[model samples]
Target: MSLGTRPAANAAERADNGAMVLPGRSHLRAQRAVKIGSLAFLILALSAATLLLGRYTVTIPDFFHIVAGADIPGASFIVMENRIPRVLIGILVGGAFGAAGAVFQTMLRNPLASPDIIGISYGASASAVFAIAFLGASGLALSGFAMAGALAVALAIYVISRRGSVAGYRLILVGIGFSAVLQAVVSFLLTRTDINVATDALAWLNGSLNSSNWDRVTVLSMALAVLAPAVVVLSRPLRGLELGDDAAAGLGVNVERSRLALIVTGVLLAAVATAAAGPVAFIAFLSGPIARRLLGGYRPLGTAALVGMVIVLAGDFAGANLIPGVSLPVGVITGVLGAPFLLWLLATANRSGQGG
Candidate 1:
């Protein structure tokens, strides 16, 4: 028999001998299942910790009772009114950032290409800051401004990066440069604003959950509810696009249209997140890479979202309780967490001669 026929006969013999699982495919499937299961468990555990551990901490029994519509003294309001909204918002914003970050990184084919890093977050922040400082806008109005700002910035990057078509490397470079400009605008606005306005703006810029409420939560939820599914629907096209525009086009994907759709969707996700939580630091930039590492480079949006949830919820809890007599913002904690990782990645990339 030929070599391929011999291998096929051996496999057939192995199967006849009661080896039910195919070695390579089954092993990969099992590994993925285990990874996904572990991620789900971690997210659930972290969520429980988020709900149970706080200043007005709720016991297991009372927490269940509160969920069951029981009127417990002091517990009901704290759980339902404050903690619930906070936790829910954390999940939504984190998921949105995570998914958006993954999409951006995948679309651009660069690990460093993320919303916060490439100027999308700054666009949202700058616009919202402008509204807060000058237009005296708050809440939903600020969210609108953020959305508009992000879209504008994304479009500008696309336009600038295009010679005949959008090039991933050029897009990233332009985005980084534009990000600097947006940051400067934010800084300039801060300096020119009144002290009180600037104080609120600074808190927003730092990305706090201090003002998380049902209204903001609902708004973000609706936005994600629309945008996330769209991202998923476009995921196949996105995967195709990753193989290069020419390959994607050959695969029956409209490369330009798909790219544009992805950019809009990603920007919208980032915008809503910034609107809700003031662009909580590094959740976007960190989630995709973390998930990629955990899942062996196959980017799953759900996994990325869960990673983001854990990061934000856990980070928020640590920021609130870990420090003595001081509560830092969630963004501060994430910034701290991500900075070291970024440096390490940079060093590693440099060592490998991958950083151009």
Candidate 2:
């Protein structure tokens, strides 16, 4: 048995022999359950409010009436055409980013290893911007190009980092370097583009939900439908791999194969979110850490996904309504919020001597 469980076993054995046992273990599990349940409820409640709290203001009655096929004129159009698709897409993108971030962080055993920070999102952004500025790509074509770029970047980083074995810090360093280069490329492309194309590209790079619609929703939905299940199935191997390479190998996990699967899966999830929502700022980076804290550092993927959904939807709401006659992109709010968090993380890491 592991060091962590040995004491628990002793305590339980003593309790079985009529001695008093510590209650912290069960209490901790119960507390985690409560936290997870509470966060899930909060996400659902926020999503409902998102659908109802826009300028048009669909009342609860109206929302239910529309859901039940009553078709209440303007309310129905707003709900069906605008608000529903936006909210659904937000949830999908948030969940994808959140889950992908969690997987990356857990697999790498480093909180700073999320796709957004590690150049994957920048890869997608650069490719999308190039497609827009040079090839006049739009819609699904842009998304496909984005995914291809993300995958290529991720593969290149992996190849560079693998010197016998892929070290987490090595991967991160390579990713950061590539990310800066890609950003410069995007900027150069933007500067050379026509005004109208530049405007469209800039807005997309800012990562807004202004263009959310049914078609984008369908694409994200289809991606999640296939990839989410793969993630869930792979999570077991991931848990095994977390116990170190030798231990995972002892548990019959092919270490290199598992790592490759995880990398590909994570890249796809992050790429799809970037394609649909333009790299919605720090949702991927922030969501995993926040979810870990809330789940008491257990790496609860589902809870992380919910936290992501809440962040994006709530951030979108705040961006739109927090100021009069001014609307910010969802990414702007997240970037602003994430900067301080990143600083705090670095400060804490320094203090703890982790040097992340």
Candidate 3:
């Protein structure tokens, strides 16, 4: 009787333990679901706000009407050529910057490691500016020249940094140094150019959505459609990297290879974004931290992208309305917002002894 009683008691306890684990698992899953929902909602709200709150007010009904029928005269041109494409470009460029920044910071385990910090944006900016200022390239031609210049610089950085395989910290440091040089080069280029060319180049460097059209949208959409899948496929390896290099290696991850792949992807993302939007200022640097805060300790890549989209669209909208007479550059607004945040981050990193 006693033996039978012991077996029954053990069985009941085991069942209770299993039941407890189920709730724990359920809690984690629910948390993730909420996070996803919140991020999705935020992006949707910002996108809708972009379409609705512009100077040329188009309500939800009109927006849908334009979408449904292309024959609607002014509505068709306004929807297809203006608001729709501008918003699309905003989302693409913002998401690319945010995602690239997140990937760099997470991979390096350094919050300061982003595409702009790495000189990738400067590379693209320099090329784009030189082409416009000196070569007199404009329109579609300038974009191609810009892309080419950006890629060339990225390749140079990769080659220079790969001393016995590029370490994350080393690559970042090298990139910053390289970017400093590029900035000087940019300054010299602008100084040498004629006033008109210089003025035009400055505007391009500053960035704006005023020039966004269907063509810009088409180019960026293609890049995102391709890169988004690559990022998703690599998410597992990226997550594993957070567990420290040795642990990730123990789990059969090729740490160095993964790091290189991610860096290349990040460079491409930043390069493409810079070419399109002239490296819209704080979206890359601010997005990761903001997303992390919103998602409550989860490193939020998708959420960060959403936040970037919101930031760009909102900043551009505010720029349109802020001064009335002059259309402020999107980069100018983002710079003002991000500069303070960057200062705060530097201070925090120092306090934490993160060795940025």
Clash count, one per candidate: 0, 0, 0
**Per-model TM values vs. the true structure:** 0.93, 0.92, 0.89
Give me the displacement of residue 302 in model 3, in angstroms.
2.1
Q: CA lDDT, every prediction?
A: 0.88, 0.90, 0.81
**Prediction 2 TM-score vs. true:** 0.92
Considering summed lDDT, which 10 consecutive residues are worst modelled in model 3?
70-79
Q: Write the per-residue lDDT of candidate 3 for residues 270-294, one digit (tens) a residue.
A: 7778778786887888888887776
Q: Which is the winner by TM-score between candidate 2 and candidate 3?
A: 2
Task: List, residue by residue over 1-356, the lDDT tens digit for candidate 2.
Answer: 89999999998888776533446667788999898888778778878887898677888988998988997879898898888898888899999999999888888888889999999999999999999999999999999999999999999999999987787889999999999999999999999999999999999999988889999999999999999999998877888777777888899999888998999999999999999999999898999899888877787788889889989998888898889779889999999999999999999999999946
The residue pairs in collision within model 1 are none
Candidate 3 has an lDDT of: 0.81
Q: Which numbered prediction scores highest in lDDT against the true structure?
A: 2
RMSD of each: 2.7, 4.5, 2.8
Question: Native-vs-model 1 lDDT?
Answer: 0.88
